[model samples]
Structure formats: C-alpha cells, structure tokens
Target: MSASVAASASARAEGGKPRGANYARHYWAFAAPAAAVVGAVIVFPWLFTLFMSVHDWKVTGTVSYVGLANYTHLFTDDRFQWAVLRTLYFTLFATLAPVVLGVIAAVCFAQKFPLRGLARTIFILPMMATPVAVSLVWTMMFHPQLGVLNYILTSIGLPPATWVYQANTVIPTLVMVETWQWTPLVMLIVLGGLASLPTDPYEAAVLDGANPWQTFRHITLPLLWPFILVAAVLRLIDALKAFDTIYVITGGGPGTSSETINILLYQTAFAYYDLGYGSAMVVVFFVLILLISMILLRVRTSR
Candidate 1:
C-alpha cells in the first residue's frame, strides 16, 4: 500500500511539469504579437536603413552595392563636413543659452513673490505653442524691413538689422527662437530640483554666516548639478534634432548658411533622392547622438 501511494504521488508531480510548460507557452504566444509589432515598426526600419546604407540606392530606380563608398564620401564632402560643424555650433548656443537663463529664472521663481503663478504660466506659453506655428510667427517678425522686431529697433533709435535674411545672422537668429521656446522647460526642471533640496544646508550656511550668493554657489549648485545635467541632456538632444523651426524659418536658405545636419539630411534624402548616402548620414547622426548621450550619462553617473 505504501509503495502504491508513493508511485501515485510521483505520477502527479510528473504531470504538473507539462502543465507548467503549457503555461509558459501560453504566455509566449500572447507576447509574440507585441514583439512582432515592435520588430515591424522599429527594428525592421533600422535594419533596412543599414542595408540601404551599403548600397548605391537612388530614386531613379538604380540600386547597386557600394559597400562603404557613401560613408567615405562623407569624409571628403565639404558640404557634409560644414553641415556637421554648423549643427554642433547651433546646438552649443541653443543648449547653453537656455540652461543659463533657466537656472536664473528658476532661482527667481523659487522665491516668494506676488503673481508668481501667473508669471510662470505666461513664461511657459512659448514652449506650449507648435514649433511650425511659432516659426511662422517669428518669420513674419524676422522680415528685415517690415517686421515688428525691426520696427522696435528703429523706434529705440537703433538701426534695423536683418534677422534671418543674411547668411551670417541666420543661425544665431534661429538659436534665439530655440532658446525662447525651450528655456521654460529647463526652468521647470531646475525649480523642481530646488524644491526638493534639503533645508539642512541652508541652516548650516546661516550658522556659518554665509550670504545668499555664497550659499548658492557652495551648496545649492552642487546639489542641483544632477537636475541641471538632466535638463541639459534633454535640451542637447532636442537642439541636435531641431528641424521644424529651422526648416520653416530659413529652409536652409541664405546660401546654406543656416543648414544644419538635419536640413542637409532632409535635402539629401528627399530632394536629391540619394537614399544610400542619406542612410549613411542617418547612421552617422545616430552615432553622434549616441556618443554625446553616453558621455553625458557617464558624467551623471560619476557625479
């Protein structure tokens, strides 16, 4: 009787194994569809782009394997090199200007003041506006002769300047638009950081007779560095990928002075119909962003 009972218990345990396997299979069956969607939507396009990058594919119905020719051409291409430099230049100013202004604004807003909520709401309105619409409005205001900006300048006893019409001033003008729209985002991030900072540091600073500036420089800034880095990373990425405002406002005009990598990529892929070369540019651009992100993340991690 004992032997028969042990055999029956072992048989039930063996039977449970198949039930567990079936449950796992059932889960995977449900997950497969979502995985397929991801592969179809995201993974496949990247693989396709990589495949096209190695070929001389054009919209003229010509396609041939070219290996690394397109990538090598980018190294020697003056226009491509200049577009990269222009992109970096625009990104630097766009990132720095907003971050600095945002920190100042955040500090100011953190203090108690009348109408603070109203001021903040008004300040962030630019960021809420659609980029294309904002660009259109700014374009109207950028007109050399008739724009309101120039009108204000002339009224202030200053000469009216060409905003985006000239090659030299085009990028800076675009950076101004970028800064205006995005500064509020940085401000919000920094403000949140300020709110969460421990009060112990301020109390200690007071005990040590430290002034507001000294306390902020010595304590607040160190504490806020991580938050600032987060804001900077976000701003840096957005600035690098800026297309709509630049496209809508300048359209890579004034003899390609304001043409960043994004504009150049668009023109190369769509206008010129050089899909292979454009794919190479896309890869390089992706790598550039990845490297910068890695570096910033390393800094954040180390800190």
Candidate 2:
C-alpha cells in the first residue's frame, strides 16, 4: 500500500495527475460490471412489476393500460384481503416463535456444559438442511396414523391428530415447522451477541449480590434486546414472504385455510392466469411490507 501511494505521489510531483485519474477509473471499472448486473436483474424486474401493475395483462389477452383499475379491484377482492390478513397473522406467530425459542436456546448454549459443542451442532443441523427437504420430511412426520411423532404422542397417552390436514391446526402446525427450522438461526445470532457481551457487567452484578436470574434480567436481557430485535426484523420479513416450506407442507391446503399472500399471489398469477391482477397484488404486498418495515424501524429507533 505504501509503495503504491508513494508511486502515485511521485507521479503527481512529476507534473502528472494520470496516477489519480487511473485510480478513479480502475475503481469504477471494477464496480461497473456488478452495477450492471444489479440493474439488469433486480431493478429491471421491479420496474416490470410496477409497469404490469397498471396494465390489464393476462396470459392470453391483449395487454392494455388500465391505470389504477387493477389496484382498486385487488383491494376490494375478498380473497386478497383474507390473504393479507393471513399473511400478517402468520408473520406475527412465525417471527415470535423463532425469536423466543432462539433466545432460550442461545442462553443455554452460551453456558459451559458437558458435550455442549456437540449438542449445539446437533441442534443446528436442522437449520443447515434445505428448507424444502426439511418440509418434505416434516410432511411425513405430520402424517396422522403411522408417523413417528404421532407414535410418540400415542405412547405418552396423547391422541394422534392430523396435523397439516386440519383447517384450524394448519397454520399453527406450519408455524411450528418454521420455528423448529429457524429457531437455531435466531440462536446463532443471539449467541454472537451473548459472546460479545462485556463480562464486567456480570462480574459487578455478581459482586453486588445479584442472583443468577436477576443478573441476567438486569444486565443480559437489556444488552441482548438489540440483537433480538435484529433477528426479529429478519424473521418478520422472511415469514411475510414465506413460500417454499408452506408450499411443500400444506400447499395452502384444507381449502385455503393456511394461505398467505405469497401462495395467493402464485395462485393468482399462474393458476388463474390473471397476470395483471397478480402484478397488482405484488405491488400492494410490497407496499404493505414496506409500511411494516418502516413501522418496525421507527419502533426500533424510538426504543
């Protein structure tokens, strides 16, 4: 670094700014390709979605400008409204479940124990697996009659119930699957936070005669709160846009009982071939998520 800078300095002293000019050119030269890819993929798709939102587009019909007609019809549609509600409902539980369980698991794993490393590795294995593969396995485990989960329940004098098949249990069951898969991620994040925490606070608290629970409550929880919120925000976004696991497990089954916005959008765009309406739904969902993110950010900053 010093040699390069000295060369540039000598070049400038020799009455030439070519070295600095070349530096700037090289920087942008390295950056331009990535910028171009981003524009082509991310920016272009978003622009297209926005454009289609205003047009009467469909699979087999002539695309025509429709202004806000698609958006208007989307809001008034009962199915879309229900799907939005379901998405929010799903997001709340799914986000909370992982965060809460993750915190507990992280706290436990942070402490010294026999075979602690092995246990943590085992715990995080589910998170390492692919979501689709996990969902497929859980699908069979959710089987009412012969599944291992039901067998264990029945052996414990509990009745085996159809999990993903039932309307009322469908969403919660899916949330459980999400929680099981993602809790370790939350754990990993919280564990990082925990590891970075200052020991002096805990030492002072202990010297101040604070009990274990009291020390953790007064020192640990407060410091950990920000990290928890980080995990919450990410989990909230993921849950809102969740599709793969839910699609594989329930397929929005039991008569749309567990359908969220993503599933609804897929069905609208592809199944119904209503591209314009689907695009409108995408725009609306995007706006809804944006509002939610802004609200979350406001709350986080306010705190």
| RMSD of candidates 1 onward, in order | 8.7, 4.3
- Candidate with maximal TM-score: 2
Checking candidate 1 for backbone clashes, the offending pairs are none
What lDDT would candidate 1 get against the real structure? 0.95
Please give the lDDT score at residue 191 for candidate 2.
99
Cα lDDT of all candidates, in order?
Answer: 0.95, 0.90
TM-scores of the candidates in the order shown? 0.87, 0.90
Q: Tell me the TM-score of model 2.
A: 0.90
* Residue pair clashes in candidate 2: none
The alpha-carbon deviation from the true structure for residue 175 of candidate 1, after best TM-score superposition, in angstroms, is 0.7
Expressed as tens digits, the lDDT of each residue in 56-138 for candidate 1 is 99999999999999999999999999999999999999999999999999999999999999999999999999999999999
Q: Deviation in angstroms for 102 in model 2?
A: 0.4
* Range of the 10 consecutive residues with the lowest summed lDDT in candidate 2: 16-25
